[model samples]
Target: MENPPPKLQVKVTADASGSEKTVHSSGLSVRSLLKFSVSATLGGKDLTPEELGELLSNGDGLIRFKGEWVRVDARKVRDLMDRWTQAARMMSSLGIPLVQGLRMLVNGPSGQLVQIPEPDEDCVMEPGQNLRQTLDILAGKVPVSIPELPSRLDALMRPYQKEGFSFLYRITEQGFGACLADDMGLGKTLQAIAWLDTLRRKGRLEGLPALIVAPASLLSNWKEEAQRFAPELILRIMHPSSPDPWQPEKNLRRKDCHAVITTYGMAARTSALADLHFPAIILDEAQAIKNAGSARSRAIRSLHGERRIALSGTPVENNLNELWSLMEFLNPGLLGSRKSFESFTRSLERGYAPLRRLVRPFILRRMKTDPALVPDLPDKTEIPAYCSLTPEQAALYQTQIDMLHAVLDEPDPAARLMLILPILARLKQICNHPAQFQGTDDYAPERSGKFRRLQELCVSIAARQEKTILFTQFRSIIPHLHDLLSGVFGRSGLTLHGGTPIPERQNIVTAFQKESGPPFCILSLKAAGTGLTLTQASHVIHVDRWWNPAVENQATDRAYRIGQHRNVLVHRLICRGTIEDRIDAMLKDKRRMADDLFSGGPEQWLMNMSAEELNNLFFGSPC
Candidate 1:
């Protein structure tokens, strides 16, 4: 009779000879001393290494060992043994790093899924005192307390913000990099600043100043926030365009400099920024380095820092590759090389849960909707305000569609492809208003359906005397929106686009927050999507779809964050029976996918579509 299939198990123990060692020479740097042994089990007992050797030599698919009959596939047996043998050699000699140990703890030591009825149940780890204590601390079972905020920290931290500070402090204290991915407007900046202050108070940052890399637009915002919250922390802005043009190497050497802030572009181009070592390197809007192979990402990785912190509302903006990039920047080799990670991602047998489990320890994500944080925040209601297209808009949109068809029929594919984005932009512009597409000053309320809807909404907002913020991707449309909103509210509102000087952006934000400030503010979506808090406004309107849920959500959070006393109403305007409507439908599915995978979708997918598919997608009957 045929015997039952073999049962595989992994046993892990702490080896003292290799106890918590570090090897900086070759391969992955070693840290923990966890030894791994793989064996086959039958009924209740394990087969010894000698018995497994005997089984390997056996010709039959069945083997009798330890006084019990067991069946095994010769190939699986050899593969398992070969994998564990290599792991044993590494663990016994140099020891495994904490990341490798964690990976092994989640996945088997072979770094592959073991064919077992239950992998978690079959594997066991017997940790030594040090490993056990570290595991307990990471698991949060053993309380590790961080120091209370010193009086120098001017602002009162919310309960969750304090928890965020502790998490950053604790994770970095253990020599692991951290990703603080709290929801936008939940105070990720404040938490990072608090941790830096704690390090300063403890004399951990005595000589080595911390480095903060942010977007150019947010450099001023960071300066303001650091000054307001942690006034004692001496800071310097290191950019050529700063009021005091920073002489990179010279300014950084000043003894009073506790932290240096620079833009990602400046950081990549300036060699002096990369030359010095920093105690802590914090990246705000960390998604800037999502492309692992980009020059910016390479430059950021080249900088040496004892502790790394990546702060972003949306860490995984595009795909798992982006997540790998962030992880590689935070902790090199934590997820292996980029090529190997790509292989793992493509392998359906390996699964993604192991990857998630491997990184869960290092990333701290807190949503605004969490039960713990909900009480401290006010309510937010998202309302979809649908609009119809005018006859003029329909004609303009159809003209662009026809133009795209003409481009599609071109003999040269590259030339045809080059026109896709411009054509798509025109199509979106037509959906906004015919005046916007025509480049005319005429934006009559009746020329566009969206304008009519905007008029109605603004009239209601003005009647209630409530303020609203308008966000759009196109800078040219800001003037048009300002004119329309000003006429409705009977007062001139404010505008912030890419052209707004960096110094003035903060001044505009500050002015808008006051009780008697402008009743409305129109902003370019990209420039003000992040790093600004406008909780004073009770309403937020998305003038057009960026087609990216992560970005649109960040824009809406500008008002829905910590300080607002009243409930917020978010208006997402959709133009019916157009590209806007179709993308709006796809947006829901994209959001659902992002929620499941922590990734995002880009419009590049549209460029790959066939002309027929494009026509059907955009010009087809809209639901």
Candidate 2:
């Protein structure tokens, strides 16, 4: 009576091409069962339409099909049943694009993607588009397309650069946004210009001018590159201080300019840009809008554009949110909203693979290490410039560590995390110099061993008359480092931090790049780490270590990028017998252990380390 104990197993399998969605139960395939069940109901025999529905509703149930009872669980069959119904609905209504429908079906109830098979004709992509080709593109398999750069491009593109241009070409043709995330100095700007030129050649630029937004520091670079590569295209730079910001608007209205270049800050601050429509909007160093809640991101969403492209080397420096933000800007709502993405990600134990699949088609990334991209790039060697803390620094560092230990002992684990963050901040500051934490602004070189080592290195560096980038994570230490570097290099140096005005950042970078310019450029890690092309600097010095090695590597890449022919040296300053040394080792271990699938930042994991581990990290000093 209870429908013989369910023993039947329902196996659902997608064919290799994903064209067929087959369900098999009791040795009967979906196609065969489709007819067998229908005939039984039509003949008024053992099963009815309602009986079939009832069978599907109960996980453990018996179904009488042609005199034999089949045992099965409805739980396993419901997903396919539901999908079958939905697919029929979609087919009868407006058909869905094969790629889009496949993407949706694969991301199941819990965001886990099922195997992809050949799509149904109703789900096939637009006429002439191949699903396999699209998959190849998403997976970054360059499928032997004749590599071509823009005919009008004044500069010669490398073979890999040409390949990059083609990827842009194909994606834009398919009506999708792109993220050209080539490593620092792999010619992303040039590739973009080439793509724009192709659009012009194809007459896609007739409706409206494309918009290019970058950091205020790179506005000049964009202008200069435009002038150099696409001389035929009229490019206008829109800025707040320009004598006539309206000129760009007038140009757009009359369609005079091929492209309008503006800074993210100006685009957010200037009301006029908010309403402007363009055929394409390209964001350079787009990580500037990595925070979804930032005004720049909101401003970007408001602008109307048919196509979006984001260029950044370090797209997701801290967490997956950064990648989500970049992808959202490039293709709004394609990955769902920020809240939806967060919820979906939190539901999975490790969502990196799913996250990659969801955004792969939209973002095309190439790294400099690919010999095909940068064959001639000189090798870079990173040396640990170890220093013993001056007695003053050592004393303050000890005191700070003791204070953090007290904070870590708080009753509330959450409260302890709150306390630990600031404590870590203070510890790093004390390592830099006692003066930084003491609020005395006394960054006397001799008071800190790291500072003393920096002086010794800079003296030798200055003798070579080569440029260097001095990077520190803390803004408060900039003045101190600048003063010391100025005396050592015997000339003024440029300093950049988060507080630096957007309009003036370009000027500082340009001044630092000139042959007669400052010998050193002091920059905070977060502000100047990613977008900068300070190839003039042959040496990169890390005044203090960030918790993440990728971040440190990004900062170093500001100098060790494509342009420099000279052998580059990277110096990471670490206090020999302190928390910095222990952390440096721990970071290396963690990176090796995680092998890049690691999602959370180092600080979060550090907080979870056992108290015994913490004691070992803080109490013992390694030289």
Candidate 3:
């Protein structure tokens, strides 16, 4: 009798959309096709093309065909059985032993043994048997392969790794929330780019739809850093120049683009693009939305996305309430209520574990302690120096204090408010020296112990070929310090203040940090404290102190941040027998009070301190 002819077979499966069908040219083996079809039908809801492929390969379930539901059976396909029988014949004809071919038989496409129905010393084989059948039979014998896990890097990442970057990646992979709390000068931008790169490498990123909301000033910086670190990642700056700010469709559709960098201003006006459903959203200088009730914050909250990352150096700048707003953005309920956060902060201050539990899972903070990843650091030592007021400054300060007292004694509230401006002006002048306002030729006839010490310190740093940064609250006094330093160190002194245009400010900072240029840059504390980098200055002098410790730390980071190779020495010049000392003490006490209030406890200072205590700090006593 003649052997049966090979049967023609066809297999069909649903496409990703499930609305259309795809027919494979060579029909799938019974076992494999059943698994693929079943998985497709069951896991078909809202599945992406890639996800559907994975589901079909791993799933095991019954499939319905032509209104008949059939459970997957290993022996169902006749073609698979015939293929295995043919494989056994080919092995035998090749002069292979029966036991050897039986060992090689393994399993067929249906996951069944490749058994030779009949064996004879001389059995004629059919001409239709082919090598394709043999391969399909062998495939069923192998076990399902397991995939490898992602490799984890053990070495510490850069200390300034932006928390926003890490948080985005963690939330996407682990479905958790996170916050990026870093001091200024730490490369938060770079960390964000790194996370994007990781996603790209894993093929998890598609359409590269990422949005970076930053300050208008830092938009260029973001563009520059993205170019430097992630050159391949396309960046489109979303400004008003585009045809339609409201419609980001043009920028969003670009093949090469990965991220859209926009300012907080633009994001507020054009929130319609939020529907694009970005894979990741990063808010740089996140404090820009510290006010939860602001339109900007509301705009950001309106955005829809799976991942949200907030970057800010001053996480709790003015109050712990600021942290609540930030956390609410990152994860709706991670930090709980404002009341609960207050409680948590109280617990944290008392070294309680609850604070860690609440924050650790979502917050990853790296300070300067990690040795492997931290950048070259400069030493920051606070030096206390006293300065005697010039006769003119002394006279002016005394007059102003007396006037302030007289105004305060008045029953009129408006008069008291008016007195504040003049007192502020006098305090400003004192920070510089009365000569700054009085006259150029005027001098502090009374020698200042702090001035003498500062001079000595300046000379020593100059001699050692090191640079210095002198900070004062008053911009008016920058010129005086420039003059005084110039007389001592010649043209090697420069001054930077708010009046300095943005372009010129950056230029001056760059010049001061140069190895062969000016050895000192005197800056108005508020102007140059937060964003500028001045690593060449191995020495930092705070001629006047600010009430906020975070502000002070920001200024310190200019030198202590990345690229400093030498130890940094910081000097806080205070008039020893003056209100400066008392003010410094009061500021420290206030910081402690703020810390206590947030750490899940009551603020004792708020209750205990009367109007008298507040008034005395600003007026009554000299240090």
Q: Model 3: runs farther than 4 Å from truth?
A: 1-168, 182-187, 202-209, 236-250, 265-276, 333-356, 369-378, 406-425, 435-457, 476-480, 492-513, 586-609, 619-623
- Which scores greater on TM-score, model 1 or model 2? 1
* Candidate 2 vs 3: which has more lDDT: 2
How many backbone collisions does model 1 have?
0
Work out candidate 1's RMSD over C-alphas: 4.8
What TM-score would you give candidate 2 relative to the actual structure?
0.78
Q: Please report, as a residue range, the 10-residue window in candidate 2 with the lowest summed lDDT.
A: 30-39
| TM-score for each predicted model, relative to the true structure | 0.85, 0.78, 0.62
Ranking by lDDT: 1, 2, 3
Candidate with top TM-score is: 1
Candidate 3 least-lDDT 10 residues: 30-39
Candidate 1 has an lDDT of 0.76
Q: What TM-score number comes out for model 3?
A: 0.62
lDDT of each: 0.76, 0.68, 0.56
Q: How much lDDT does candidate 2 score?
A: 0.68
lDDT of 2 by residue, 391-469 (tens): 8887888787878767656766566667777878888888888888888977788898888999999999999898889
| RMSD, every candidate, angstroms | 4.8, 8.8, 20.5
Off by over 4 Å in 2: 1-83, 95-100, 108-155, 246-251, 270-274, 293-295, 337-340, 343-355, 499-504, 593-603, 610-613, 620-623
- How do the residues 1-623 of candidate 3 rate in per-residue lDDT, one tens digit apiece? 95432221212111111121222112221111110111112211333445334433433345443353333322322333355345444543233221122212221011112443322111211211222232222222222222221233113344335334534454434333356665565666677777766655555456646788876545556766677676766666787643433248555656666778887888888856666787678888777777777888878877865566777777766666676687777766445555655664664544645444344445555666455556455455766666666665567667766665655564544555555656655664564555655656453423434455677767777777778888888775666567667766756588877676544565686577778978888888776676567888888898766645666777888788777888888888776535676656655556665454422211223233344653685566642
